[model samples]
Target: MPSSRHLIGELESANLLGRGGAAFPVGRKWRAVAERASGRAVVLANGAEGEPLSLKDRTLMATRPHLVIDGALLAAEAVGAPDIIIYVGAKHRAAEAAIRGALAERSNQLRSRVRMMSAPDGYVAGEESAAVHFINAGDARPTTTPPRPFERGVDGRPTLVQNVESLAMAAQIARGIDANTGLVTVSGAVRKPGLQEIDLGWTFSDVAAAAGGLARPVQAVLLGGYFGAWAPVDEVWALPIAAPSLRARGFTLGCGVVHALSEDACGVDATARIMAYLASQSARQCGPCLFGLHAIGECVRRLAARSPQASDLDRLSRWSGQLAGRGACKHPDGAAGLLGSALSVFADDFAAHQQRRCLRRSTSHPASLQPVAAVA
Candidate 1:
């Protein structure tokens, strides 16, 4: 294998970011693992599409299994990992089958060092630390971090847990292919809800138009998945899908999900449902997560139900602010980010809910993944 420096430098030049929501720099991550690995590290090709509305990862794995395998092999070699694990979600049968079959066509030496693991289905199961914890303990829940996966992971060896999409892009860059696109999963009230490979700097309108345009009047867009914030549709329709661009505008391209919220749906109601879902997915490892999330969910639930007491609004605002940086993992932070964004994005509706004068809207589809047809 070539020196890790070469691949890492290429990735840096390409300015690659992880596709699994965090958008961390790919080169920086690889450089860290390369530094930590002592020929005993493990590489995790995370195909665990545990996020409810996101299907870009599995879409890539099922459609281009070889691409994923190539990236994983490259990562193992570059990071000095002797073994690689393809962690596909237990429910992602097609993706698992694709990779399994792809591996069968590879060389014997490559096949022997790689293994497949069933990732438990949950929002947190795909998290890097949780993925490691699952491999070690058979329980796919997040553990507190200090010794991150790169420092110490499976079998007490440093591990590199890169998202499958990130791996694929790395492979593309390695092969001198243009790696300037990001896969975004578009759903909710779109005429054609599916996964599309978007140019990183394309405007949101372009992505939406590619999804067959809007099926209804969209009031706002959930720019990121549950972990990301929401912004008024008009306010962000011109913002580029690129992470740095979105971040400059006080938003993130979280998990590459662009779910359009219909004017027929209530953002407060939608947010409440998401809050409850995130709360239910908690690992129950710490107080802030176990209790605080439940409390926050209940408050939002009351607001959504149009039965909030006066103090409930104040509590929701304050509690969400206090929830960040307090959990065992980022689980609480995700919930906080969603709730905080809702408080701002749907402030008018929230106030309406408190005044018992809320308007009617269509039902929400929080888990509406639908079939992810890749944009050709």
Candidate 2:
């Protein structure tokens, strides 16, 4: 068994970052829990991928359950945590079965310490705070931060909520291997839409090729998920997909989602639909998240339908600024990020939509806009 200090050193050398959207350093998070946890801590493997465009977590859970479990156990040992919980979305039947079968293979002591739980099928259900709150109380809504999960979570004990993909990488790091590749889910207008293990430094075109190339001529790409930013196809095709590289360009490889839009798709219409879906997923706890998202969604819809007033765009810009950082959670901020990027990245498309002259009849069916209850 590796000491907590040794494990942190190994992770730091491997440069293993969290595969979650935040891209936080995994080693630092582990060290924080190790030092701050006063008593028995909780290790939670978060496989409840609330991002609709992302399937990598479910794929990892179902296909590589052992790796995820190994990582969780390693984390448990590192933090001196006795309890481990694998949280999956309620509808993820295959992943649940895989995890349960894997858990059955462990020793009685290990099995006794590990368990599984079903997460609510909502976008915010996968948020770290929301997951901690759900495990502590019955509600899955996010709470205000200050005493973060690592500080106080799960019955007032420090908790470590890690993404499943991050755990899989940690499993590799435990075996003296450095973190190199990551799981990516490439979908939408692709010839072969599926999950692929990609090298960290690979370019966007490399990712596209792993999915057998684009099924149609590409117009733009949503680099992350619904809460992520968009980039023109030409601008990002050759760009490296690594977090640092993308972050330098003011973007992230958020949840390893790469959704491509076909040349014939209407960006304005797609953005409007996605914004509306995000609005519906709000917890309704904060005024900015509930009311502000609704207002922005409506405005985007009107713009998509070419029925917006002259000042609609200006109002959207202003409201996005107002809604950001004002909510208890980052729900409002994520919506604002999506809307702001759409306005900037697809300026021509939005302008055309406002003039009732869409470039192409939209053939895009963004998975991000699908009803959460309908996904499995």
Candidate 3:
């Protein structure tokens, strides 16, 4: 195995970014834990894929469990940590079984330091603080920051929480392989909706082509997950899917979710339903997330149902500004961002819905909005 300094140096050189949506630098994260450790640090392999549109992590674990295990082991060795935790999603039974079965094949020394736990079902359960909190307290909800996972985690020790794909990439990098490829979860309107392995050079268009093309003429795409916003088809059709590059361009490749909206679908209606889902998944640790998100979700829900009050749209814009930076985690901010995006990408639809109309090209009754699926 490479030394801690050597491996971390390589990670930095390769610019390995987290695949868990944050796009945080992998080396910096491991270094923070390594520096804070007295051989007491912990490595957490995050397979708690709570994003409804994302299945890359669980699929990776089920099909390539050994790679994930190797990455976890590498993370532990590189960070001078004796303990490794495979924090997989509770709903991902096949992944859990695969990970456990793979661990059984490892040497006693390697297996002894590793343990597996089922993360609770919900989106917030995938947050870094939430993962640590769950391991230490049996509750899978995000906690307030300051003593972040790096500063303190799991039994009050520094921890490195990494996405499973990022770790798989790490393992590949360790073997002198280039980690230039990524996995994207393509859902909604694609003929074959599932995982698409993409090169760093691939664009959103390529992703679409790989998924067997769109089933219909898409109006827009819900890039990232529910926390992300809708991008008009023209705006993102040719956009690069590279996480870091996308972030630089004011876009987020969150959790590798790329959901296409069919031409016949209502963007406003989809956004509204997604908002409701996100609000329901709140950690409920703070008022902004608990109450404010509910309020925003309710407003969108009413708008989707074509019964918005005179002030619903105005309140959405206002509440987005009001709720940002006031939550325990970034949950409220994410919700606000999504709402903001919806208001922009679906402006026409919002206005039409206000007048009991739908802009869908295939609408049977143009004056009445139809029930649309929410990125299903």
Candidate 4:
């Protein structure tokens, strides 16, 4: 086995980035913990797939629990941390059970060092700071930064909170393998929506095809989860999935979600529903997040229902700008990103809705805006 330094060096060489949506360099994160003077540290494997459209994390935990555990243990050893905590969403009972079963198969010493905890079921509850706060205070809300988790986390020690997939990749790197593939949850309007292990260079259309292709032709794809942006089908279907490539095109492969919106599904209506959910998921810690998001959600809902006044669109646009960079976490910014992208990518749809001429029939009862139920 390679030493921790060698492991981190290999991660850097392979350019492994966090799969937890942030895409931070994995090697740099580990080195920060290893270099800290405080030898007291902890490792957290985040499997709280709180993003409603994402199922990749829980799917990995269920199908390959050992790999996730291996990655967590490897990270614990690399950072000189004696304890590892696998944080799963309370709703993900199967993932929890799989992890516990995986833990039981490890050596007594390894089992003693690693434990599992159930996180609250909410979007922000999976944030790194929120996970640390929950471990320390039993509250899963995001706190102010500067004393970031890496600097002061669980029990006032440095903490490494990594996504389960990122840790899985780390485990592979430890075995002298370069990280090139990612797991994407291809949901929404697909004939066979499920988890897919795809190469970074695969085009969006290729991933859709691997998922048995679309059940209906799509107008746009919601890349990433709710926190991610939208892209017109014409623009994204042939685009590469690599982070740098997506970044250059003003997109992120966040939480590895690729949701398609069929032509019959009004992009405006779907975005409105997601925006409302995002608003409700806020920690309500800041004014911009609390008030700004709610206001934006209401405006989009009106626009989607074709009941918006002429000024509603302008108001939504202005609020999107006002809410950016104002939240304690990135919740507000992400909500803004989703709404802004919808307005831009589906401008024609929005215009049609404004004139009470949506292409799809609006359901008499709006679809319930709730997080996707946890799957086994």
lDDT of 2 at 163: 96
Per lDDT, the best of the predicted structures is 4
lDDT tens digits by residue: candidate 2, 315-355:
88788677789888888888888888888888888777667
How far in Å is the alpha carbon of 132 misplaced in model 4? 0.9
lDDT per residue (tens digit) for residues 48-123 in model 3: 9888778889889988999999998888888888899999998888899999998887757583289899999999
Instruction: Report the poorest 10 consecutive residues by lDDT, candidate 2.
Output: 367-376
Model 1 lDDT tens row, 1-376: 3355698899988889998888899889988988878778899989888877788888788889999998988888888888999999888778888888988878575832988898987999999889999999988877787889899998889989999999999999988886789899898878888788899879999999999999888888887788888889998898788888898888888889998888878888888878888999989988889999999989989988888878888899899899998976888888898888889988888888888666645545542323355321
Model 2 residue 109 CA deviation in Å = 5.3
Would you list the C-alpha lDDT of every candidate in the order shown? Answer: 0.85, 0.85, 0.84, 0.86
lDDT of 1 at 33: 89
In candidate 1, stretches whose alpha carbon ends up further than 4 angstroms from where it belongs are 1-4, 107-112, 363-376
The TM-score of candidate 4 is 0.95
Ordered from best to worst lDDT, the candidate numbers read: 4, 1, 2, 3
Residue 301: error of model 3 in Å? 0.9
TM-score of each: 0.95, 0.95, 0.94, 0.95
Candidate 4 per-residue C-alpha lDDT over 189-247 given as tens digits, one digit per residue, 9 for 90 to 100: 77777788999999998999999988877878888889999899899888999998999
| Residue 216 displacement (Å), model 3 | 1.0
